[model samples]
Target: MTELKQERAIRTRTRIIRAAAEEFDAHGFAGANVASIVERAGMTLGAMYFHFKSKEALAREVMNSQTEVIEPLLHSEGLQRLVDITLVWSYALRDDPLLRAGVRLAVEQGSFGLKDDSSFRRWERAMTECLEAAKKRGELLDEVEPALVAQFLVGACTGTQLDSQLSSGRSDLTERVVRMWRYLLPGIARRGAIAAIDLDPGRGRGA
Candidate 1:
């Protein structure tokens, strides 16, 4: 395809994805309708079909794109960076329809017969990388295992956000995440390092 046509196709695909995210987030997989997504995207059925063959394909794309909102933290290292990333993610969970939809879809995918663990594995890998850096820097306890800690962090954040969403539509997720780190750090960090790490829940966003 020519440059112009390729750009247009990309734009149309993005529009369909965003519209599908909105529909999925609001109504979930079973309730979401392709016609509504096409209408919301202001695109014809052919355009959506050209990019995504089915709703399951669109959902897979959404799940695979779950890391987009946390793109800002992809290169960050250390325990502090981990806290910052989770806080940023909690905020993104509240403010980004695409992320919220992706997470919700991932959690509910079993019901839809669309199983994919790549997103969850990615989260674990990212956390493990950060924890490894923190361990190398002497920020964590000598006995702390990066892989275990990474798993714990992912599970904690997932459950915390799920509860926050259920209770307050995620309005207070940042605070909840802050509490999570506050509760978790004492057990994982070195005595001197515990007090130094920033768990502000507002670090990455300039708050």
Candidate 2:
């Protein structure tokens, strides 16, 4: 396609994804209607299908887009990044239904795919790489298994989102999320019941 055509296609695709996000966020994945999504996008059902094969595809698009929001928190921000990430996540759970929906979809992703896509795979790699970097920087225990720790961290975030949903009306939930981090993150990261880490990394994005 020509550059202009590619740009138009990209714009159309974004509109459809946005519409799908709103529908799915307001209504759970099972409840989201493709017709409604297309209408909201001001595109025909044909146009929607031309962009996305199914509602699941649209949800996947939203999930993929979320990496832009999360990758920074998961990588490169160091220990200080998680605090800000958690604070923002809690606020998102309270205010942005779309983010909560995205979280829900991510939690459910393992059950849906026959094979995890490259994007899904990257989440683990990103976490592993970051933890390895922290270890090299003397911020984490050298003995800690980076991959295991990464998955555990992801599970912790998922649990926090669940807490946010269960408490639906609470505002101070952010603090609770922060406190829960200690349990999952452990101020002293250890490896194989030995080599406990020291020092507070001063939580910011990644705990």
Candidate 3:
């Protein structure tokens, strides 16, 4: 009975989070309504409150849930892996409401008095790890710094996606990300490794 109850609770929480994500995606943090979220989830207020205490808590949860959709890529490594990660994320931004909501919330969090850069830091760390691997494999330029390149890549991606979102509602995000890599690779990747790196945005779809 306890196990069944726990499972039910998990499902309820997931439903609420999804609904909250949808609402926040459409309405931003200040505009989202808890009543509407409950209605969208088809759950009672008590059920939602049982999982998340307030709208702030729900927003934070939604922001943190962005990474839940990224699955590990198989047989990928080094510079190509980092490129694939960005491409995969670009695709995910178009398909996943949770990620979209999280991204919007992350950008707008400061307006709501929520100061958190953990998401950006997390992406920088992931990119840095891949860059470090690339460095070991001689794929990186001799003068390139993994941490600095990673930070710059994260900022570049963030700005690229935001522009794509503003112009085409992210319809052009993947293409923009491809363009971003095309411009970035020559600066950070070794001359010999440049041709070997795949810039196909679709390369990560199957990965």
The lDDT values for all models are 0.84, 0.63, 0.87
Q: Per-residue lDDT tens digits of candidate 3, residues 80-188?
A: 8888888888988886778889899998898999998877787788889889999999999899999999999888888888888999989989888888888888889
Give me the runs in candidate 1 sitting further than 4 Å from their true place: 1-6, 73-76, 204-207
Residue 60 accuracy (lDDT) in model 2: 77
In what order do the candidates fall by lDDT, top score first? 3, 1, 2
Number of the candidate with higher lDDT, 2 or 3: 3
TM per candidate comes to: 0.88, 0.74, 0.87
Residue 92, candidate 1: Cα error in Å is 1.9
Order of candidate numbers by TM-score, starting with the best? 1, 3, 2
Per residue, candidate 2 scores C-alpha lDDT tens digits across 17-62 of 7787788778767778889999999988998898899888888777
Misplaced by over 4 Å in model 3 are: 1-9, 73-75
Judged by lDDT against the true structure, how good is candidate 3? 0.87
lDDT string for model 1 (107-138, tens) is 88989997788878778887888899999999
lDDT of 2 at 134: 60
